[model samples]
Target: MAPYQFIERPTPFNSKGGSTLPIFAVTPAHIETGTIDPIALDWAKKAGYKAESGSLLLIPTEEGHLGGALFGLGTNPSEQPYITGKLARTLPAGDWHIETAPLTANRLSLGFGLGSYRFDRYKSEKSSAPTLMIPRDADGADIKRQLAGVFLARDLINTPTNDMGPNELEAAFRGLAAHYKAEINVVSGDDLRQNFPLVHTVGRASADAPRLLELRWGKKGHRKITLVGKGVCFDTGGLDIKPASSMLLMKKDMGGAANVMGLALMIMDAKLKVDLRVIIPVVENSISANAFRPGDIYRSRKGLTVQIDNTDAEGRLILADALAYADEDAPDLLIDMATLTGAARVALGPDLPPFFTDDVELAQDLTEASLETDDPLWRLPLYGGYEKDIRAKFADITNAPAGGMAGAITAALFLKRFVSNTTSWAHFDIYGWAPSERPHSPGGGEAQAIRALYHHIRQSVR
Candidate 1:
């Protein structure tokens, strides 16, 4: 097996070992009070720097070389904690350190590291971005671990389907498992069809065989935390093909898997005390003569027959089999993530992914962690009211329900059916792609919900 080109190299934070310029993050209040360096303040005044949030201004030395810089925090600086991230793009290529900032050292450093990401694997001219020296008070190792996980997910998601299909995804999975020295088992072909029927059905159309990939790590006696991600490498919506516009970004259909892989990296790197299991049902929902069609019914691994009301609803079918298989383990926590519904995007937009879980403590902890880590997550109800919608006339359940109301909820509910054995289970319907650039994230395959989950898990282990 030759080295897969798509498995990205780890992009870590820079150490504070060399010459670095200072960056002072100033606010309008600071300028008004004249608390900043007088020379720099006067220069900012001459430059008409308004201290607008996310704005940057570079100072010059009398010798005409790079000097200190100013970053604007605006009035309510705390409103956007990752505001310093923009500096990674705007700063000249050199080592830099924060002299003063409204945000904590951890946030400022983390933001810069995240903004420094570049997915230029295919480009002839690779990106060259400035680096920030890790703050002495910040957890540099933890930040590096987080960035490594995020970069892994982003790279996997950003890769085109030609380089990231089921086979490639399996290779990446195997690579990650090998890196961590974890135990991995993959089921495909006849075994997958016989045992995980729904996963096989949704994926049968692709040239590459569909696979159920599982990775187990950590000591057996630790708390069991099992994660399942929908690995639809490419979704042409099966026989119910998507329009050209909808198909453009389908390479990111495996975002859920990417994210969990990243989160798993964080957990494994941190050496968190937990038994971790990752389940990825890998497939490419393509158009072929054998592609599962609308109205097709297939029995799942859990013995529940699923009626495919729409072939585009293939993610849930694969997840159904994976979740059922995971449920049998009765892990302390069971989580499934997927790019499952457009309705979630319509409801919450892209930045904030909606998570569904009935566990109160888990929701509260995740809410706290989201705020702490700045990983945006909103909890949507697993509303029992919509339970009747997924019921099918002939099969046990319909992969897609009619009247498209609360589609995200209905999808969560549909996945919930196979998860009865697990006491604590959560589902995240993630957009997984940043439509445009943001403070800490660029416009490409994004990692959603994992940071909060990582912090939540860390706290749980403690």
Candidate 2:
């Protein structure tokens, strides 16, 4: 897909007349009051603009050329933030500019730019969509940084499993490393067994060798921030195999990895003050004679023995090794994301992801960040009492419990065992896929907790 074109205006108040399409804002009550601009009101009235929020109006100027559109934002000016995204989609296929509006410069710029995202990689005729020009007063650098990360995540998730396996994921990480001049280290095949045994065990069955990809950036003296993501490129449920119906959309099992990379890109691009470490355990959970069985036991990097209660719970297995490796450094902050359990979706649905952390202060910060960014997350208990369910008579712990009463909590608890050294650690069991399309979010590989996390990390390290 071609790179997104973002236009920067010289000044917020100066209206550059290069755009072919113009969008005018209107309110429902404005039509009744007749107090709006006479020229705009007349044009709107002629175009049958009722001024219902989210409704679009297109008018033809006196010239033969096509006129601009009229968008309805709600009565409250503060609600205008929601309109930019809607405008991105409602506008005609031509260059557009916000000539006049009540929106703040930053909100107007970022919302419109983000909403304009569309994955057209496989499309025969690409979308010649109009570009949105940012006002001079707007934070163009920040807006572009955020959008770049988001588009990167969407592109990765939209890709099929055949083209985005373990090796492909490593290549993608390597590209990011080369771009940022970060040091990249990958332990795969035999090295994985020697260093990250649990990661090797789960991915040993697939043709693509399972590996742990680590990228280190920033100065060593800065505060350490570690990110762990489960990169199950494709999940066939291993020996416990998923049915054909369940296997559909399995390509999205790597959403966690995509999201972490998205957040990493944002941090690196912004040059946040922190020592960053990103660990992704790339694996393909496929069926084979060598596939780990339910009764199999594997020793983790931290030397904890984990008994496999279910082959389908391979995500936590790979994450176990990555988390152990991350904990070894004793980072100031640690976060791991995975589509680990179905119970999280059952509890919070697809829109809201559930996060678990033992630190109250960290939890509060994340909750506030979620509310501020409109990317909300619900806090689920680590529930130390539930640890008994994961106890293995022969091993230190079991990957899964017998009864699936608290699947999400148990999984979080399982990961918590591998993160004892970090002062502040959080785990997010994200669904990663949007079940349906919304105003700004599409149905495919959606990014969960990225905005909130970015905000939280920025504030925490500062």
Candidate 1 accuracy as TM-score: 0.97
User: lDDT (CA) for every model shown?
Assistant: 0.89, 0.82
**Tens digits of per-residue lDDT for model 2 on 34-103?**
7666666788887778877678777677784677767777677565464577676767666677766777
Q: Per-residue lDDT for 1-462 in model 1, tens only?
A: 232442446453566665788888999988888899887898898998989998888999889877889999889978888877789888887778888887888998888888888887778787677778888999888988898889889988998988888998999999899888999999996579888998888888899999999999999999999999999999988788899999999999999999999999999999999999999999989888888888778899898988889999999999999999999999999999999999999999999999999999888988999999989999999999999999999999999899999999999999999998788999999999999999887789999999999999998998
lDDT of 2: 0.82
Query: Which residue pairs in candidate 2 collide?
Result: none
Worst 10 residues of 1 by lDDT: 1-10
Best by lDDT: 1
Quote model 2's TM-score: 0.93
The 10 consecutive residues of candidate 2 with the worst lDDT sum are 5-14
